[model samples]
Target: MTQDPSRADMEAVAEQVFVALADPSRRSILAALASGGPATATDLANRLPITRQAIAKHLTLLTDAGLVTPEHGERRRVRFRLHSAPMQVAQQFLAAMARDWDSRLDALKDHLER
Candidate 1:
């Protein structure tokens, strides 16, 4: 069946979020931001075991995925802030799929009981 364009766009975003979250380092970076608020790559590197350069690389991917946004802070330091919209969209996508499966299972149960 054909999918709606909006649905397709959301699915694409959710896919990006999933891809970004697939990396453990990326997840740790996000967790650090969530717990400590916005921070630069150096700050994340200090908090986590990853190097500054590696954190910077992961931050780039996170920014592309809309999982994090960069803001210029004092001294022009770019701080990465966690953005939850893409993740929320992904959660909604999973919820929709789960609902679809639940309805199908319920229908099968009813049919078997008949």
Candidate 2:
């Protein structure tokens, strides 16, 4: 397989994902869309305590991070839905980090035992 990019780029992508997930309200918004399928900001507003305006702001961030996609609807209504691509990339990055740490620990253990 191809080697992963430099740490700087990986960190940037991870940072974006982390920032998108940092807000509790955004997480709720993601969960709502994930569970309820694609929906408008108004639809999400009804299901969540936050106002539609707030949800719209959160959606903008999500879209920027590639976590959510917006579908243009009739009458200027836009539907937002969870996009798994960014999350999948983030998950893979975390798993790779875990594996690297595990290998480093194993090497340390070998050195101490020597």
Candidate 3:
């Protein structure tokens, strides 16, 4: 049986996702992958204004963050495919934080209304 990830693990993954997403270039790369599907660094360069070297760098970071997976294609080409698991973990983290804040804020409003 597979064990579920601990909260710490989830937070760590979420942190990596957040750091990876902090860059506009990385975000653009992700958006391109989302719209165009899996693509090589050269393919991304062709689609985005970013250079091939820069896209390769951004792809490295995205791979490290578990945002994308590299697949070997014909002629030894590496195509990057979007991976949403880490992003989902980050979304869960944000949702949990929002829930906590919502409850606290509701309590504060109730206290002030009294």
Candidate 4:
């Protein structure tokens, strides 16, 4: 089936971010990458309790969601690094929603005061 471009917009990115972050292990993997910089799947596996295969699966999902990027270094070493774009998009969305709620609350407060 043909994909819908509109369905894959910023909102979709936000959705992907939420889905990717929903898993605790994935969150830990992301944190590891964020704090330690780029790391190979084996490195992450060693750091976390998760096995290499499990880490690889999470990395694949993260990569697909644009949360992480993979780079090939010398000796064919591939390491994954976090990408901020998707997270930033998700943060912007949450901020906008918070602002909307604040505006509505202020309006309600003013109406009650008047």
Candidate 5:
């Protein structure tokens, strides 16, 4: 069954999502996850310049951020998949920020024109 997220939960989720995306390495990880269905730390490390250990750390952060989840597959291999809900929240937050900036800019323009 699905559970609806509360306001505080959404705020927490959004904070974590933004924090995860703030790092370039994490963003790269997310990109990789988006391109590929799921990948192990070793697989991601092989694709990127970072070491497997570093990749694992990034994966941990992403997992804690609720942007990704690990699934067991093929023995001890742990694969991660993107969780798009928080991403959608991040996108909406960004869009809202953009809109607010636009409004402020429009007001500034009007003030300058007067």
Candidate 6:
């Protein structure tokens, strides 16, 4: 049987994922990465108006947050790909929050009608 991840592990990963997405540049990077499998810093920079250096900086943040993984190619050229695990965690958190809000709203409506 598969082992479930602990709550603390999920929370930590979710936090990192959220923090990475909180930045506009990083979000844009993720979007670009999602559209195309993996891209190098220069490739991403060419797609965006940003400089290669700026893309590198954003990539570092994304790597740290576990949103992206860099693969070492010949000459150590880094290619980034999306890490879906953290994204899933973030989605689950949002879904839970929405469900909680819905329950609270239903309770409020019931109280008002009574």
Q: What TM-score against the true fold does each predicted structure earn? A: 0.91, 0.89, 0.87, 0.82, 0.75, 0.81
Encode model 4's per-residue lDDT on 27-88: one tens digit a residue.
99999998999999999999999999999999999999999999999999899999999999
Q: Which candidate achieves the best lDDT against the true structure?
A: 3
TM-score, cand. 5 vs. native? 0.75
- Give the clashing pairs for model 2: none
In model 1, the worst 10-residue window by lDDT is: 4-13
Report the C-alpha lDDT of model 2 over 1-114, residue by residue, as the tens digit: 555566556656777888999999999999998899999999999999999899989999999998889999999999987898778777777987899999999999999999
Better of 2 and 6 by TM-score: 2
Report the lDDT tens digits of candidate 6 across residue range 1-114: 543566557767788888888888888999999998899999999898788998999899889888899998988898999888888988887787689799999999999999
Query: For candidate 5, lDDT tens digit of each residue in 1-114?
Result: 454465446657778998998999999999988998699999999888889999999999999988899999888899999989888877776676689799999999999999
Q: How well does candidate 4 match the true structure in TM-score terms? A: 0.82
lDDT (10s digit) by residue, model 1, range 23-87: 99999999999999999998998889999999999999999999999999899899999999999
Error of 2 at 49 (Å): 0.7
The window of 10 residues in a row where model 6 has the poorest summed lDDT is: 1-10
- Local distance difference test values of all predictions, in order: 0.94, 0.88, 0.95, 0.92, 0.87, 0.87
